[model samples]
Target: MLVIQIYADNPLRNFNYLIACPSSREALVVDPLDVTRCLAAAKQHGLKITKILNTHEHWDHIDGNEEMRRHTGARLYAHNGAMGVIDHVDVGLYAGDTIAVGQSIKLKVLDTPGHTRSHVCLLANSAVPGLFCGDTLFNAGAGNCHNGGNVDDLYDTFSQQLAKLPDNTKIYPGHDYILTNLKFTLDREPGNRAAEDMLNMLLDHDPHNAYITTMAEERRINSFFRLDSPVIIDKLKSEDPDFSAAPSPRDVFTALRARRNTW
Candidate 1:
């Protein structure tokens, strides 16, 4: 069986994941922002940290790589494009590369840029599939295109890459911005009951608790992924008069992202 543990860093709201193969007791740490906390979690699970995988080179994501590597002697992996940005990367990976945790578990890397040009997501291809999407994808929103990130790239990442994942794949984002992102979705798509229902359900849970949402759930609630929805298209057209030229999904997506930036 595949074991996944989520550790949240207080104050920052960053989520770090520890994934392991129970039979082999071998594990990989994903975006460990807090080395001490991650080490403690690994110790609690009695799993050996064989590898450290980074989703992006952002300071918050790769900050603990050096410390974690020093303590665990694990090799660090990051996208090849993040070389200078992530100084401690021992092995630079590409889009189609796969990393083995043990004899049974494997993590497939997807080059999901736009949050940052070098960003990647790790998907666990097992009975219980999970995606460790960094800032590239949030629960109801997508990452901003600031700091060398492009909105068009983010659109493709969502509509092309991430959209291809199985609907049942559990989404484990880098941050817990569900409530806030849902509020933004509600603002844009007020008539969407899926977003409203999800917002209410999430409101009842402890805000600090780690959330694991499925792609099916995201497809319904996430405004960024619903570019073809009539409500979203109407809203975009209403907001921008020039958007009457039979807006493509990309056009609607770009407008949503632009509005989100100021929201």
Candidate 2:
């Protein structure tokens, strides 16, 4: 299995993915916001994109769907719940559905609804695990529930689902917000040496070169994964001293999400 992550030169800083089988060279594309870039990348890799998949119905994630499908004659795959919002979906994907790319790669869909009620993340159990999390999760921060999403559901998805991934699983989110998200980590947990070190590293050279991250590393850097940290709780307490006598992890997660909204 071969996975190529392409950074889209768009205002949203979207990242499109192309996962293919080395032997067959047939690929599956995820959230193609830039059709031309996706096509060019596929061409460079000698890959034929056989399927275009969207994590949800967000415009930026699906903007290139029609054009990509027309260009490659690729079938579109998306969550059935998002069918109402996204057009021309050839396959209605569901939780546990496995979509095969070429002969080796089989992406198993996981129902993750936080960024949107219909959002889904894909898992590729290759030599190294990869999760195409889209807007459901990010490098240092979890996605917001502003657009047709629920924070409680987001909490459940994080605690019940994403947290179970192996420490080595590499998260391939839809957008590049790690630098800013890491800053948010320091804002809440100012004493976090790991986040500080990562923030400084990202400040050097081209930050995109420091993009790849693993779950174990995220445990040290991502604030969302560190809801139990006393420093973060103290920061939140500084704002509302009586918020909770002893805040639960869920409470801390909720408060952090709220603060990030204004950050």
Candidate 3:
């Protein structure tokens, strides 16, 4: 069996996940911001840290890499494209690379760029189907463009790569921004009953508990999934001057993300 544990950290409230394969007693840490917490958690769980899987090269996601790798002798796995940023990635993953964690446990790397040119998402069905989405995806929404983000690229990644995953897949994003992102989703899709109800529920409680969102839920409510929907495209055009003309899905997504980044 495979188990996942989450640790939230620092100013960004980044969410780090530790995945373990019980039979082999081996584990992988994903996007840890602090090595102290990751090491502590590993000790508590009685699992040997074997690998460090990076979803992207963002400082927050990779800051603990050097420390954790040195302390635990864990191999660092990252996109082959992030050569300079992430030093010594033992397993350089690509769009279709498959990584074996233990017996009956494997992660399928999907090169879901647009959040960054080298960004990728780790998909697996070890226990529950899961997606360790770094900056590429978030709770109720997706990542904002920071370094190499292109709206068009994000659209293709979301619609083609991520959308292809099974609806039951559990989406564990790099950060916990559900409440805030849910508000944005509500604004973008006011008529969505699920979005409205979820927003109401979030407004009444703390956002920390709303960290995890399912792929099934995202498909029903996330604006990015509604690529051909006139309401979504119209909203994107209204907010993004760059998308005033005939724009592709990527152009529209970029504009929306640009506006959100400034918010």
Clashes within 3 Å, all models in order? 0, 0, 3
Taken over the whole model, the C-alpha lDDT of each candidate is 0.85, 0.90, 0.78
lDDT for model 1, please.
0.85
C-alpha lDDT (0 to 100) for residue 228 of candidate 1: 83
Off by over 4 Å in 2: 205-210
> Which is superior by TM-score, 1 or 3?
1
Error of 1 at 217 (Å): 0.8
lDDT of 2 at 244: 93
TM-score of each: 0.95, 0.97, 0.89
Worst 10 residues of 3 by lDDT: 204-213
The TM-score, computed over Cα atoms with residue i paired to residue i, of candidate 2 is: 0.97
Q: Rank the candidates by TM-score, best first.
A: 2, 1, 3
Error of 3 at 220 (Å): 2.0
Can you write out model 2's per-residue Cα lDDT over 77-189, one digit (the tens) per residue?
99989998899999998999999999888899999998899999999988799999999899999999999999999999999999999999998999989988999999999
What lDDT does candidate 3 reach at residue 34? 75
Q: Residues 180-205, candidate 1, lDDT per residue (tens digit)?
A: 89999999888889889888888865
Q: Which of 2 and 3 is ahead in TM-score?
A: 2
Per-residue lDDT for 81 in model 3? Answer: 91
RMSD of each: 1.4, 1.1, 2.4
Better of 1 and 2 by lDDT: 2
